[model samples]
Target chain A: MIETFRRVLRRLGSVETTSVLIVLCAVIALLGIFLPIRTSNWMVLPFALLMANLLAALATNARLKSQSMLFAFHAALVAVIVLVGLDRLHAMHGRVEVAEGSMFDASAVAAEHGLLHDLRLGEVRFLQGPFEITYAPGMKRRETESVIRIPEQNGGWREVRVGDHTPLIFGDYRFYTTHNKGFAPIVTYVSASGDSRTGAIHMPSYPMNENKQGLAWTPPGATKPLKVWLHIPEPVFDEAKAWKFVKPTNTRLVLIDGDERHELSVGEVVSLGSAQLRYDGLRSWMGYTIVGQSMIHWIAAASLMACLALLGHVLSVLIYGSRIPAAGAEHGG
Target chain B: MALEPAPRRRRRSHLIAAALVLVVIVAAGVVLEKMPGSGPTVATAPQQSASSGVTPFGQAFAKGIEAMRLGDAHTAARAFDEARAINPHIPEAHVNLGFAFLAMQRPREAATAFDRALSIDAKQINAYYGLGAALDASGDRKGAIGAMRTFVHLSDKKDPFQRKAMSALWEWEAAENGATPQQGEADAKSKPEAAAAKDAAAGETTASIEQQGGAGTGAKPEAVATKDTAAAEAPAPSEQKGEAGAKAESTAVAMLDTARRNNAPVPPPLPAIADMPDALTPPEGVISIVNVWASWCGPCRAELPSLQAFAAALDPSRYRLVGLNVDRDRDFAREFIRDTAVSFGNFWDGRGVFAKARFQVEAYPQTLFLDSSGAVIARVSGTREWPADAAEATVAEILASGQKKEPK
Candidate 1:
């Protein structure tokens, strides 16, 4: 037993063995780019074992001028690989499909845990879910009844929805929804001939500014041209008012009656003596989008940097070892 | 001899490195093979049809052509509308859609579609012709003539069909001012009939042109001679008859000569409008409503029904409604309209200007309400409600007061 141990140690400490180990490590680093190490719990143990074997092999090799530097560089690489493997064990990710006319809450679980992260919302169903949820940088979810369900890898799901944008950091993985168009404008049309008719119409919602003009429809050969205006719910008021292109919060359509004038609210109908007009509902909502927070993306980005560092270190060692005379031959006496 | 061990160890290490590199190469190749392919595949699956995959704009274009060929301005208008929903950049779609509107007797819509097509693609040939056709149909003869002159300038004069169509259109313009070839033929036919009527009144004998067999070739010359001789003699009934006969002979020759020179084949008379696809036949216990609208049409935009409300109120089993959008931009149309809770299908009419030429539509927001038998029970040309107790009230009435349709 003692003799076999001695022979094994001697072989491992040889210059030839050190050269072979360097070649093997370089090949493994290259392989990592394509067939990435499996980070799941089941694969973690095998990965650790492989890493331990590499460390042991590196440690037993004879010391040369650059040996300590190479060892330190490789040691850092192993540390990163182990850390990433642990992260994979805890990381969570999946996809979900929400049908038209439905709102999906992605925060139901995170709310219970009192955690929140930025969210993304895309294409709301006009009737069922009027608004798509999204998150801004550093935004957090407030407590609410809104529920969103996100799928988990282990055949479970997480719930989330509006009002949750931060404090929900589970491992390195965070969740987001797609951004989509959300603003829906309500338009009202009043006929000019004092018969107060009103209709409800919808227009695409634009960024909030008080200056945007509302669109109105005119009927063929109507006694009076259609008098049209828009009603925004939350009117942004300003004194200087340089930017009039911004949509107003409060808009009303005023029509002239023979003797009296009448005003129609957005999405309201009025009858002015036979010339019926009404405020039409929104035609469309535009310009909503969903995006992920930069932080989570940054965490995944670190793995790439580690990979590049290992690649550079391996190349330098290979080039230096090939160009210089063998250290073992020079030391021979 | 001393180099033997070093050389053997070096060779062994080199072989191991070479093997490791080969393994890495093979593994990378395998992984690359599994990577996703770039872009969408154009090779359609066997189950998919070319027509089904066509964008909304293409579908509207094809439908407009089909409608024009069949002379059903309304149906053609609806189809062109579907095409415009897929793509608005296609100017031809708008031109053809306008033609459909024109044929439906909606001149205003035809003009708008033509104008829109020209705005998107200035060199659109069909839009120019459709504009002329719409103007001609709408009682704006001078405008029609001007548009036709533009059409003539733009058209390839070398094409036989186009040349004939241009000549016929010009002739129609001329005829509107004075006597036409058809009118000349009628006058010729009338002269003989008048001679017969005069003979009955005067109690005198008149030579029947039909009786002059083989003398047919000499008929014109003899008729002229007889007219001169009678004029020289006395103011008798025969002299009056001879003058009418000579005029009739000249008119007939002119008519025949014009026909020969133009080599113009008379087009079959316009098909009865009712013979066209009136509307989609609704299932039993259902009312089929077709709403014709355009994106730029303000009133049409205002009166757009709350799809959700309509879908909720109307029992799908009893009522079906379709929106026939005449929008020039397919993306804008789809994005704007898709959010509505309308359960029924939508169609695009591609005849931008020609819709008016083909459909004779005078305005937008035209609602054609049809019964289950597909017969148009009533039509609302503007934004107004049908009487509360009429066959069915308009969408505005239903949403405002929760008005329900009484059973027919």
Candidate 2:
């Protein structure tokens, strides 16, 4: 059994076995790219095998063991692969939309995360403030300047302006502004039973669904839902000229209940059968793409170290050739 | 005994180094675990719940339909749910509920509802379209294409949604083949069935439910969107004559003949103006309705009478109606307008620059609703009966929206 184990280790440490493992990893990676398989879990197998093979090679290969630079290079490569694996295990991607003046609710976010992702989004608290977005002609979105307020050590708030490029980082997570802003109608609802509540209804995205600016909403206290359409009497933006994102002041909520349609302006009230709706005003909402922090820096560092060690080993071999004394050569001499 | 073997010593040192590296990595992991914000927490998805009541199925279904017509998918869903609770066998309720869920962006629930509808009634045509759309949204393109194909096969050729389904199928197939819809459409020309489907070709097909030639039960499924409700209106006298109507005018033809006598390809209807006028820049407090039209466009000529009447009836203080003639040959446009007796302020778009660039118009007879600031409030493609109440109601809605902006 001991002899068999030694033979297996020797085979695993062989260059031919390393080449086969590498080819298998490449094949798996290619399959992942071409096919619709999730590579996150599948990648761990090949990497783990490669790491084991490398360790076996480090232990059994006498010539390799004698070379410190080559050994260090291989060790750095192992570290890089391990770091990348850990990173993949904990990475996450998410998206959230917050209306201006609203608090960022972590629970409202839609995300996909790895198995070991630390869900600490609840610790990240911030409030969305006013944001400005510009558009070029033909409705091509340009820059976005979103203002967000984060809590400070002192009970006050510290304001930060983040945009498409900049991210509002919170520990390991980052919130980046995306080009998905739209109109949000703030409305107050009063049920026939005298219960009242108010909130904003985020409409469909602007310019993209400019004509279809309608949404079906159920009020807080109402039994029946109502359909609300934002009616803009004037041009939203000129396709011929550059423009900025702004809420139209001259817009009304066209509320439809059953067969009845009533138009309401700001502060105006319209009665449905079971409830009454009051148009408070219109506001804007911004969409954000969220990403968890990664181990990319460590991976890059390890890779750089590996490259340097490999370069040093190559230079040593080029300069000294086989004259570089092996471990037994020095002692035997 | 005193001197350890050099190879063994070196191996032990390598082991120590490997152990140290392992210890360091483990330590780093431990530090990271102990770092701030690494606490155990669970992310919760937003939840939505609906309440049901003890209501009669008939009343609930009616309420659902009314709510759907009003665009209230939530209420419609609830009502349908209530109706389904009272009577789970009704396929229409399930179908409508599926559509409501679709409107709410819950494609999974919509698919379930559509599946239920299909389980109840295999021939529920609307359910197939809803199922296809839901499946498509849920990233099941193959299933979506299958469902849409089934819908097209089961539906009448004249069914309005059949054309939409055909368009969707073409898009999906094109996507699957790594080609564009235009390319798919080009390929479709060879297949007779696809050609029949392609004949509709968006913004041109004018078949209505009555023209379905008595296919199925004739139970019209409610439109998912409220836009383009006027697309099914009957054609006008000019539309009945089609392109031949443009040649009906004696004076217009005579002027064209005069241009033909000169051997010039229909010279300018009148003396060539130095420069074409710019697009309509609305005055303060006035809303402008720019009707983009061309003499060659049959639908443009068909809707001219209603537009003329609607323009005449508009309140001059608040609204201004104008014509954007995109006819390349100025003679045809000038004579056509003269023959038609259209008096609205006509601006020439001989080169179609403003029509294409400013309005982004693809089809003719598109009306742009611009505010006093010359910002486009809305763009209605295709034709609508201008004299109808729907048109007036649309304008009234716009007027109501702008009421707050009126100078106090």
Q: Which candidate ranks first by TM-score, i.e. highest?
A: 2
Model 1, B316: alpha-carbon shift in Å? Answer: 62
| Candidate 1 CAPRI assessment class | incorrect
lDDT of 2 by residue, A1-333 (tens): 987886788777777778999998889888888887644666678768888888888767765667766777777778888888788789999998888777889998999888899888999888777889899987789989887877666666777778887877788887899978798887877776888887779897886766456767777856677767776656678977899988776566666555334545565454454456767778888999999988766666666667777898899999889876563232121
Q: Candidate 1: where are CA atoms >4 Å away?
A: A13-19, A27-84, A88-172, A175-333, B1-143, B152-408
lDDT scores in order: 0.43, 0.64
Give the Cα-based TM-score of candidate 2 against the true structure. Answer: 0.47
TM-scores of all candidate predictions against the true structure: 0.24, 0.47
Question: Taking the tens digit of each residue's C-alpha lDDT, what string does model 2 give over B1-408?
Answer: 599997887777676655544554555555655544311222322221111222266557656644543445578679889978878876667776776676566778978988998998788776787788778778898998998899899975645566567867987888888985564443343332222222211111112211322111101222111111232233332222211111111111222122212222221223222264334757888888989888767798889888888888888887889888887745335544643557676777775666777668778888888776667777667897686345557687655664343211
For model 2, state the Cα shift of residue B240 in Å. Answer: 44
**TM-score (chain B) of candidate 1:** 0.31
Cα DockQ of the candidate 2 complex: 0.02
Question: Per-residue CA lDDT of candidate 1, range A1-333, in tens?
Answer: 976774565455455554665666566666667775532244334445456554544434433223433444444445456545544433434333222223332431222111243233232211112223333333321222122333445544444333224222223223333322223333333444454432223332333222222333454336543333343334333333322222333334433332222333333343433334544333323221223222222233333334444575467778776754444342231
Q: Pick by DockQ: which candidate is best?
A: 2
